[model samples]
Target: MSVEPKMPKCWRKESKPHKFCPGCGHGLALKALGMAIDELGIQDKVVFGCDIGCSLLAWDFFDVDIVQTHHGRTTPVITGLKRANPDLIGIAYMGDGGGYAIGSQHLVNAATRNEKITAILVNNTNYGMTGGQMAPTTLPNQKTETSPYGRSIEETGYPTQGPEMVAAIARDEAYAARGTVANMRQLKGFFKKALQNQIDGNGFSFVEVLSTCPTNWRTDAKGTWKYLEEEMTKFFKVGEFKTPAAKGEQS
Candidate 1:
């Protein structure tokens, strides 16, 4: 009789448990990314670059070659990686605050350069690892340490649409999209496409995944998922912004 092969683990089991709050969204996002790579059969060629903020969790979670970049600098690191070795799949994973606020310049520059890589921005709305401070993506009237009374647009301005905002800088409008992970199905699709962008050698593919920071959002997993579903998607619409064909591929 033939025996069945061993099934691969979820990659979450590889985490060191070094740091990260209870039920942190970073863990789940990293797991989803790994599963996506696995599904696409490209884990061997993926180079994961993680930004500061909570995104650093991905550094320890994946078996791929990892790079720890400066706060908001993961973009350039991944860009350079892809440029130098176009055969490798480069991914820059950054949180909302790190990618949109502090690393905003790098984010735009990468798109402007039209570097072939996958940039995944995880928007949890608040600064999760940093004492629950108000972030650039915080919704209207959202309360946080920095915006105790709620985020004031007149004073602080509104949040940035990282994916849509950067699409203009992109070379084409085929693989860029603003999506979320409230549902497993959507999350799977987002990650799968992100990997495909790299494999296809698309100039740039940006996916802003709206995640839940249970600790910073001040809600448990259930409540956080609800908030991500009902409240978060309202601000960041989900859909593709760019999808142009790569050098030698069909749409």
Candidate 2:
């Protein structure tokens, strides 16, 4: 017998029957985020900033104030919002394309500057909302709409490892980590920790969630889950790249 999952009261009941694809992983990531907010009782104090792509669909999903921003612009907007109102919890929800490609500079600068905000980057490898194109996070030699002959690392460079990149800065007090939607328990833990870091007035917290794009990948639910577990994890090593304790601060 299966049991119903406990949902967060922070979720909008009117947004039920979400618009994500059948095997998409965005739902799982969003659920974990929502539950984390609910657990921390910060539902009303949150300012969710969603970037272009599938992540923008979450603008109405949360009961908290949400704003949909242009492609690769969510981070700066959230950072500015947090700076303007330190009392508000700033969250940047974005897909791989928005987080790794055009917005990567903003991400790096925000981390280096120690912006007090939380960023959740859902990496589905390909650009799901935009015809499954080759995103910066796409695995090497992975076939996508733009990489029909498989991605050529020789020409395209390596996939963007977000957590590792952000964690490499020794002086920054940024908490960086990576998790997968396939692993709900671990994913939720990562989400909660990232949120708690912000609540504790930490500099910056980032969580990269390895997700699936079934509709874009042309895979069913089962196949998509398998890909996320076996294939995706091979390229994106899941772990806590850095924590607040590493910076000698309690998270």
Candidate 3:
């Protein structure tokens, strides 16, 4: 195995506040994460590394320790955190662009090496914090600031299927799943499996969450729900891609 970096101490202060917009999916994702850690009683053991975009807004969401990394670079930080502290539950929370585009190389390598970490990849479709830009996970022909005329197939192609991509490379012992926060009950189950993957000592668990970006999409909150439910779910199916049992071991 390759050498890993050391985990640092938790460094969140009470005065710091989360910067996410109201009704943003990132805030819900963070809430799920916090609930999972709290239920498992591992708040102190979680080391959060949030990448750029709305994900960075989660910097102060949790009461545990936290760290910020450059755009699309949370994978390396999480990798280092796991290697440094085997006991720590290292999580890399990042936006679609940060994960599938700028940080893809790191993501693939991390999965290949079976790095012991959990990555919560938020695919809000459009780039929210970056003025509604098109990301690698942007759906086919999705309109954005740069693609007012719609994304060109010859240039942009289709959005990357992240869970499928990781599952293709993951070892049998690893876990990969897709989930959505459109509803509360489903969200709880998804978050449970995500955190369980970490507790199981399984390597390289991934949860690709199909999220909403109402502000960027220039849609009302109700419209965001409709898109997430009617359209985005069609393109990005949500479910578990890998599991401990399928990995040739008891789950």
Candidate 4:
């Protein structure tokens, strides 16, 4: 007899065999998130909002209340939900394009305002759902549909340092971190901390996860791991950039 693989209780049972492309990192990221939710026991109080792009595929990935927003609008939608009902734990999930490009303004304003919401952005370096177009987080010298000749640093500048930007602008009580799908434990820890920060009524929490997109990257299994564990980590360092200071402690 075969035994089913263990899964997070908050994950939808019917959604097994998720819709993400093979070798894609979104599933791993969501798994870590689901585990965090289960461990925290806040499944009922959580409100999940996903943006356009590949991230939108997770609309029914969880058993919690979910909202699918337009491209880059997940942040505002989650913010509105949190403001309207402070008791709810709001989570905004999106891709690099949604968080760094079209929805950048919302991200900036939310961080500056210290919104009590958790924002998770998966950085796969390209617009995964939109034919692998060059995105704000696309690395220099990387090739994509729009950047077929390879990304030019002089023309496009460097990839967006999402966690760094959020940590720099958000208030002292806010939490910011960068995790990778390669390390599920660390990613889950970051997710737990971010959610706890919101549960404690702290300021904004943001986590950027380095993910893989083999279908768009045109890479095999080995190449996907190489890009995610080696190439991507070169530019995007993984670690906690900021965390809430202990009570009576200086920031």
Top candidate by lDDT: 4
Clashes of each: 9, 0, 3, 0
Runs with alpha carbons beyond 4 Å of true place in candidate 3: 1-18, 246-251
lDDT of 3 by residue, 80-124 (tens): 989988899898999999999999999999999989898889998
| lDDT ranking of the models | 4, 2, 3, 1
Total colliding residue pairs, candidate 3: 3
In order, the Cα lDDT scores of the candidates are 0.78, 0.88, 0.80, 0.97
Q: Candidate 4 at residue 104, lDDT?
A: 100
Let me know the TM-score candidate 2 reaches against the reference structure. 0.94
Taking all chains together, the TM-score of candidate 1 against the true structure is: 0.89
Global CA lDDT computed for model 3: 0.80
The residue pairs that clash in candidate 4, if any, are none
Candidate 4: residue 87 lDDT (0-100) = 99
Candidate 4: regions farther than 4 A off:
none
Please list the residue runs of candidate 2 whose C-alpha ends up more than 4 Å from where it truly belongs after superposition: 1-5, 170-172, 246-251
* lDDT (10s digit) by residue, model 1, range 176-251: 7776665556676777886787687656777888887777778977887788889887788888776676566775
Q: Alpha-carbon error at 21 in model 3, in Å?
A: 1.7
RMSD of each: 3.9, 2.3, 7.7, 0.7
Question: Per-candidate TM vs. native?
Answer: 0.89, 0.94, 0.89, 0.99
- Model 4 residue 114 CA deviation (Å) reads 0.3
Better model by TM-score, 1 or 4? 4
